[model samples]
Target: MFFLSLVVLDPLVVVLVGLVRREGIGLAGAVMALDLCGNWWGNWHWLRDDPSQLLRLLPLTLFGVFVVASTLPLHRVVARTTARSETALPSA
Candidate 1:
């Protein structure tokens, strides 16, 4: 349940990341995954179209982890850069 929300949440986060960073081919895949999951919960037609149900489980979860793996490290990099930049600045 928590993970589901996190996965759904990440596309939004990464959309901002992509916009700020100006890149999104892979993150766009995450959005598609969100669409699959969203559609599944939204109606019965989704299952009739994609009966395998892989969308809600393996792929989306994997993409979510991938998104987190890709972004969390980037966050650390940004934080480290910001800290270094701040320390290098002289006090006013």
Candidate 2:
């Protein structure tokens, strides 16, 4: 249950950050797909060892980790970019 929650929440965090930063829908979509794919590939070896036990949960777990990973960086990038844009804008 904890793991399942992590899996579900992590990606949501990423999407939230992306939306806050106003990232294009296309880029966000790509990021999500890549995040999921990367997680699956990274964990495939471990999951294979106990295919029956972990296979069912592997996709969700991997996705969660991916989202968590993706979100952290996105948050930082968005913050920095937002700052830069604000600084660049002319004074009112």
Candidate 3:
């Protein structure tokens, strides 16, 4: 239950934060997709106990690593883009 919550909640939180911050929809969608894929991969093992536990774990672990590696750069890009658009708007 805890893991399931993490899987669902984390992406939702990220998406909401992105939207509230006025980040691009395309980028937010991509991030959500990646997050869901990673969450699925991370939780795949719990679906069944197979002979390929390691195989299932491999992708999950890799996904985690990828998330850790990419999150900062992704956040930076979103922030910069949002800032640019906001600054481009004419002052009221």
Candidate 4:
């Protein structure tokens, strides 16, 4: 049940807000870490039993890593763009 909340929170709270704000990227990265931990914890038993099942979950793991790895670069780009836009705005 708690894992389900993490799943919902990741997209709705992180992804949607991140689309509108650069800080969202950092939030998304944090949420992704939590999600990865939750998934690993939830699947530990099955993974321990079969081992090969890790293959099936590999893509999810990779994606989480990608999100975490890219967050800083992506956030910097967004922040730079926003700063440029704000500065470019003429005084009203």
In terms of TM-score, which candidate is strongest? Answer: 4
Better of 2 and 3 by TM-score: 3
Better of 1 and 3 by TM-score: 3
Compared to the true structure, candidate 2 yields what TM-score?
0.47
Which regions of candidate 4 fall more than 4 Å away from where they truly are? 13-18
Clash pairs for candidate 1: none
What clash pairs does model 3 have?
none
RMSD values for the candidates in order, in angstroms, are: 7.8, 8.2, 6.7, 2.0
Q: Judged by lDDT relative to the true structure, which candidate is superior, 2 or 4?
A: 4
Tens-digit per-residue lDDT, 29-90, candidate 2: 45566556666677678777867756665676676566555755766777788899899999
TM-score of the candidate numbered 1? 0.41
Instruction: Output the better candidate (1/4) by TM-score.
Output: 4
lDDT against the true structure, each candidate: 0.60, 0.63, 0.62, 0.84
Alpha carbon lDDT of residue 71, candidate 4?
Answer: 88
Best by lDDT: 4
Of candidate 2, the 10-residue stretch with the lowest lDDT total is: 21-30
Q: What is the lDDT of residue 58 in candidate 2?
A: 65
lDDT of prediction 1? 0.60
**Poorly placed runs, candidate 2 (over 4 Å):** 1-15, 22-53
Each prediction's TM-score versus the true structure: 0.41, 0.47, 0.53, 0.84
